[model samples]
Target: MSSEEEGCFVNILSRNISNIVDALLHGPENAFDEARKEGLLEREDLDRITNKESNGDKIRACLDIIEGKGNEKRICEKCGQEAAKRCVTCGILCCDQHLKRHQQEGHNLMDPGVKIEKLRCTVHGDLFKFYCMDDWSLICPKCKDGQHKEHEVVPMGTAPNKLKVVLAEKHCRVLKSIESNESQLHEVQEEEGQTQNAGRGAEDLLEKRRKELCQIVNETVDLMKGQINKRKMEKLSLLGKQKEKLEQQNESLHQEKSSLQTALQEELDTASFLQGSKDLLKRLETMSDFKSVERTPLPVLDFSKEEKNLDGLITLNKNFLEKIEKGPVEHPEKVELDQNNLRRLYGRSPSLDPNSAHRQIKISGDLRTATLTRTGNQYPEHPDRFDVHPQVVSCDCFSSGRHYWEVDVRSSRWWKIGICLNSMGRKGGKSGLGANPESWCLSKLNNEFSAYHNKQRTSLSVPGDHERFGFFLDCEAGELTCFGDSRVLHVFRGNFMDPVKPAIGVWDYYCDSVHFVHLVKQTFITN
Candidate 1:
């Protein structure tokens, strides 16, 4: 075909492109394949059309490709004559002689040289003059009278202004979220640096202790040094994981903000802009529900008290070297509660307080188990609720007498079982199990166990497989002791000035429920 003739054919295709796209979209699933087999579409064009998410968008893209390839000779579909006019309603090419007959039948007609913009509703075949706010769609007058009758409809011209306000607000929120993520990332990096410095300091202290004990007990010094190094590595590992998580969150926020900015800068029509903005805004809202990372001082190793005890032992026993020649000597025995003592100390099982639970914590129907969830719960705002950590406290508090409790932690690998002052902070970084001065906890993080109090950690030597843990608190003696299956793990000594409640925390989503064991006399058994 000649270039002039091809131009005329292209104009005819472009004039009724919307109708052609609509027919192809609703025709069949193999329409693109058929077009490709007929040599009207190329392989790359088919691939491009397939990339579109919606059927309408795919057909429109295909029509664009076909229109660009409009160099073949064409004839009027009605008669064996050169096509000169196009029907807008039926999307058929017809010569001027046959066009007059179609015009008499009330079909819209357009010249080959006239280019038509697709502004008509596909369903109603009327020009879209209204925008439906409820559905975020464009509608015609007939559509407004039918399905969109109760919708918030406005003139198409005014819809862009309303959408601009919404997009602006969403843009501001995304910016703020990006800023918040950046701030958290900074805090995590700082914590990481502090942790490294603290680790070096602890190593130095360990070196000094090694020298002091090298002369009297070389084997014990090596063991202590190994424990210190292991603890340091664990601390650094935990901080590294936290830093990585914060970095990923910040990266996601940046991408979301970039997409929003691109949409704002594009010269899209009102309908396209509204649809794109609606999707972006929904995603922005979801991504904006970010939780702040809890900032706590990294725990450091303090073997000063242990060093003093070892020094005292060395001074008191001159035959310690002879005893070391035999197998490993036994240290002072830890208090192991028998079945009778356990039964005597066992009090009523304490239930978790829903109001004190974090939004990601789900309290069970029995009120004794607290489980971590991937999504936040629709919890009502309460002053005692923990906002930063996935932690919760018991409903009852102990003040005057001795109290005993057991937690079934068989299902979780990372958990904290402890007691905190009833007046402890509940909304900040220090609200965690043992982050503040008002709490004491024995935590099992991965394979390591440690006792935490006032942000200081004392590494405990305990078996990792112990599933049930017992806590015995003597308020009068100002002592809180944690016991594994057979032996006491660690103890925290402090003046009990206020009532304390049992608390539990779960850090990871993979962790299961931390249950408060209900003590029954019939099945009472203790290790």
Candidate 2:
């Protein structure tokens, strides 16, 4: 079709559509409602909302709005207008004006038909029964007299007071629920706004990435095409060189033939010339054999592979950028909780003696080749940093000044270990607890996070579970075995650099086979 004709048709169709929309919007009773609600509803919108299939939905929505369902009701009690069913007992009402006052006044009223009924006496008609001193129901006056009247009787005034207290409690609970739900709703709205902002950020990133991709594509096209052209030129130059070589060979052959003809003029030299010419021709033939050299192929970008890698990198970049914008890193403090230190902190172990300051834990070979073994807590004074380790652990730094150690549980004995770190060196500060800083997986699996510390075992590698919390020191690349002789419950790993420092270690309660073998030197982990 002609462009002009297409444009004319599009304009006519658009006008017709607008007219049809106007008619559809202003068609019926709800047409006015729609106009007031959201201006005019176009024909397409009307069709979607008022189709036969959606009639039930429309009716339900209308009922919800008209009948005040799924909406809060506020009315003025003084005006007596049926604003909403704010209270069933008092029939409280409100309008736009005095709604707040009515809400405050009628909010304390008891629910209709919800009050406890009086237990009437069969013998004495009007007087209500009284509650017994014991945890029993109310008794009539006659029954009280017959049952020997010593039981406590709630006074008439007491009933009202008790009911008021109960009702107040109920109202407070309702208010609290409303308040809590509103607070949660506000938080959700804020979170939603943040998510939308993140989406906008993602869109902006996508646009930037699109520009970069376009630039890359243009550059790639140029490079690839230029490479192909360069290959073509190289092939042409090689072919020209081969042609020159062939021409030189042909000329030399022609010269040899002419020399042979000159020699053939003498009969005696004829045979020799012919033989020599044949040899020369053979040599010429060998030189004329040109090996077909293939031209180098163009470099393939493997754009698909590159595109996948770029996609991953871009996604990571977007995530990283968003994280940087979000900004949640202020740096958290860590605690080093080992056996000797834990016991000392918990008042089990004693403090190091000032008089006999020679108490020491031995350090031998390099952490990688040597072993990190603990004797027991030698201190006899301070119990604040006490722990329940099977042996006392004191740290010894290796020659390289690297701290490495291991914790070996006694045997297949049932035990547990816990570990904590105190990076701030605060004596009594708040900290998370349990073996791991995650969840509480119960029974044979329940794990919880709790903050705790130990004082005696100042700095040592520790590793353990919640039930048996202990500090952990990085062992060799060997598997970390647990529980029993079977390797079934082992945590396997590869190798890592751990000689940097001696980390706190938490280990099993039993002294069975628990051993710490450091790969480097010992690290003195102090504040």
Q: Which candidate is the best by lDDT?
A: 1
lDDT of 2 by residue, 1-527 (tens): 33333223222322343343354445534443543354322344344445534444544333222223212323233453334323322333334454555445533222212211222344564233344433234455676776637765553223334433433443344344435434444444444343333323333344455665554433333333343334334334444554454444445444544543443344432112222334433443443232222222211212232223335442333333343333222112332334333222211111111221112222223221111225543545533232332212223321111121233333313322322221212122222122232101111212322222222111222234422322222323222212222112322232222211122222332233323332221111111
Candidate 2, poorest ten consecutive residues by summed lDDT: 437-446
Using all chains and alpha carbons, the TM-scores for the candidates as numbered come to: 0.43, 0.23
Query: How does each model score on lDDT?
Result: 0.69, 0.31
Error of model 2, residue 334, in angstroms: 34
Writing each residue's lDDT as its tens digit, candidate 1 over 1-527 gives: 35444545454445656665765676534645654564544578667776788886886676565455553544566664666765655666688788887767755454543333455788877766777877778788999999999989987667777777766777787677668767877876876676565535544654566566545555555444554555556667866887787777778877876886787788865556765776776676666354434433344444443444444433523354443444232222332455345544344488999999999999999999999899999999999999999999998777644567889988887898899988899998878888889999988887899999989999989855888888887766788878887578887998763678899998885437898998653211111
Predicted structure 2, TM vs. truth: 0.23
Residue 131 local lDDT, model 1: 77
Give the clash total for candidate 1. Answer: 0
